[model samples]
Target: MVDRYVAAVDQGTTSTRCILFDHAGRLAAVAQREHRQHLPRPGWVEHDAQEILRNVLRVVGEAVQDVGAGPGQVVALGIANQRETTVLWDPRTGQPYGHAVVWQDLRTEARVEELAADGGRDRFRDVCGLPLTTYFAGPRIAWLLDATPGLRDAAAAGHVLFGTVDSWLVWNLTGGPDGGVHVTDVTNASRTMLMDLAGRHWSPALCEAMGVPMQILPEIRSSAEVYGLTGGPVAEVLPGVPVAAALGDQQAALFGQTCFAPGEAKCTYGTGSFVLINTGATPVTAEHGTLPTVAYQIGDEPAAYALEGAIAVTGSLVQWFRDGLGMIATAPDIEGLALSVPDNGGCYIVPAFSGLFAPHWRPDARGVVVGLTSFVTRAHLARAVLEATAWQTRDVVDAMDADSGLRLTSLRVDGGMTSNNLLMQTVADVLGVPVVRPMVSETVSLGAAYAAGLAVGWWPDLEGLRRNWHRAGEWLPHADPAAVARGHEDWTRAVQHSFGWSREPSSHDGGAPSAQPGR
Candidate 1:
């Protein structure tokens, strides 16, 4: 019998990757390419949609050829993408209006503040399960329509279309500009702040409030289904293969980690860190600042819900240490440097580079390194950098406990940062729970593949996929509880110093002060 495989496209913040997985959920082949990040102005981040599309095609072709897989052997394709990255494009040419506004972009911060002034940030929480913030797509869409000349009128008239990265990839893969399917999965839609939590559809009230036209939005669909088949440019690689699934990267990690039951949780550490717990069928209202979101939906069955805590900067902080400060040659070197020191030496770093997310939701906060003294060395700073990510994870875990009234017993972890043994130990010590990693560290891609395979009947069911998962490593808390508590207290103090560093200008104000460019 011929071997069959499921392919997944992981379009992340930094790069685009294609991976082929075998029946055992092990990676058969992989290919990746980095796209350029465009920073046109201060607080603005963009990506060329055309470049991303081209990269996706290149990687897909490369991955398939790498394993020498036959044409029909690659059975299905799934997309796991960075959510809330807004793309507006012309349907006629299938060309983007401009660069895509990344989730980390703060260009919409002023508009978000304006909207929140009326009813506070949580005004939309009851309906959409999201707070008013620049992290979502609604405010970004509104800003694009207003800033671009004649865009509002065009969008309102249905001349332009709006989508997150998943929709963009799906539309292009199916058949861009020639009967391409324009739709978004519930997981991605839930991050836009324009979808009703209960109805699982676009909310009219949110459209009007965000100044977005209902016509421009994509049709919301389930996470696992055949949206369309590969056609157009994508046909060159995997012709007629079903595009079976679409999921936000973090949710993909959750699914990949096999966190199918309620109370099961996973944390993915990448450009950012996201902690999501499966909360069963019903959406849980988060009182502690975590956001309720759709985990996944299969066919016509009810959607599974999750509570997510998003931390804006985790692995990116390491990137800054390597690139910005030239402190180390590469990202992995931080672990070696940090190990040279016994501890942080009373130092702490709050990486609020693009302002904080989750729990605090403070866009005014800036990155701060506190407790700096003559005794602190570069090694101590490296340790502090790693500790920052651990402390942020602890904050979210605490919030999750408060909202659900259940303590997390263990955490399933993945992403590039998990390769650092010291970092994993730090996370376990800080959270007072065991940190576990699966044999397949690429849970984001594996999750996408699992959904795709299930849709095409390539896999039996969720239980079959769960059986494929195997434990790779585990870290247990060894630090003194009293010492950890004191460190957390000091970390909280350092976080407070980061707040109120940047003030949002009011509409009545004549002008705001000029700001420096961000990383």
Candidate 2:
């Protein structure tokens, strides 16, 4: 019997999650599995693409089975994925040439340096709406082609395909090694640094400049449209279910937060934290460190654009406290440890683990812990860890305000970290704006489900999605104005100590060429 349920596959940097949403936009069942993050060397990160594929299949089956729903009950499937992670696979065998290069990986730093030498960073910003940074997939894809043996020739011959996580899953879901559809939504394509922002297609000049073959690029489609039906192992759980929507994780959260109108904003705190403000219809070229991207595109409506502030580290700071420092047993223990200390105790931590992103695109920066004295304890360090997350949000929020000319009075926030009352209140205090959390914290997956449901007539239009949103709670600013100023002042000083720490002795600048844009 036909039913009105949508399945969303939220493929993130650290885990794969599958959520089933009922007609009213409530979660019926959910399942998630964390994958291994391979650090072959310092400043490098990777994931086994094939393992992610297996985990995705596992979670989808588990979520669907939890609610005792058959394939007929699941009307469609949508995808929301960690953007800019480059994956290259063979079309003939459906096997990745190597482990997927994560967005946090710095393996392509030298390549970006070369691009910066030729022209200081904003070389392709006009056409592609991105800068010459390792944060994008273009350089990573180029590095994969150069580092992997014979991959370039194979790409040139069209034997290989290149895509972010979404394309990899969509191809495998449709029917890997057979005739699966190879496509990605506009939101994902916008991050590749190879797609034309205005044209909404691959830019030939930028592609050639980045040394990527155009033949391997996937077809770009609207965020809310049926790309193909599920096949292969995915078909076993929901055969013939239409895979209707695909969006980058940040954009998915924006959609899920119901930030439909212009100037509406949201910050998603996950492995990384991102601040995106919606700029309706026409794209705004960013002069600040912010990058302009497509929020989402419906069937016939003009594409909505966004100005994004991408922070390289947030939740990962907590992970380091747990795993690297051995300060806590689990991820949640940091909050308790942090609460033991009233303040940061004159210490600050700049988690430039893979280098700082947004506002300060200093790729040469490394993680730094400043103002440490004999009096400091693990509790103080823990407080600094949580404080780092809040300060980083302020960095992006300030940049967003400058680029968009709209000051945010309140922020709609979601993700795993929103559960921490201390972090939420700190964010409010740091930004001087109310931090609002939605009743449904799983906005990432819900956004994908909403897009897919809209495509297949499960939800008629935007009004239906707006009706599904409701606030769960809020955090108002409580910190004294003087304290806030002093905290931000110390944070600024600590961040300065982090810059140029990772570069060679001779390089005073952040490893980029001395030439600035227009020089």
Give the candidate number with the greatest TM-score.
Answer: 1
The Cα local distance difference test for each model comes to 0.89, 0.88
Each prediction's TM-score versus the true structure: 0.91, 0.89
The C-alpha RMSD in Å for every predicted model, in order, reads 3.5, 4.1
lDDT of 1 by residue, 38-135 (tens): 99998788999999999999999999999888789999999999889999999988999999999878798788778888887777889998777677
Per-residue error for 6 in candidate 1, Å, reads 0.6
Candidate 1: worst 10 consecutive residues by lDDT?
510-519
Model 1, runs deviating above 4 Å: 319-330, 372-377, 503-519
Residue 56 local lDDT, model 2? 96
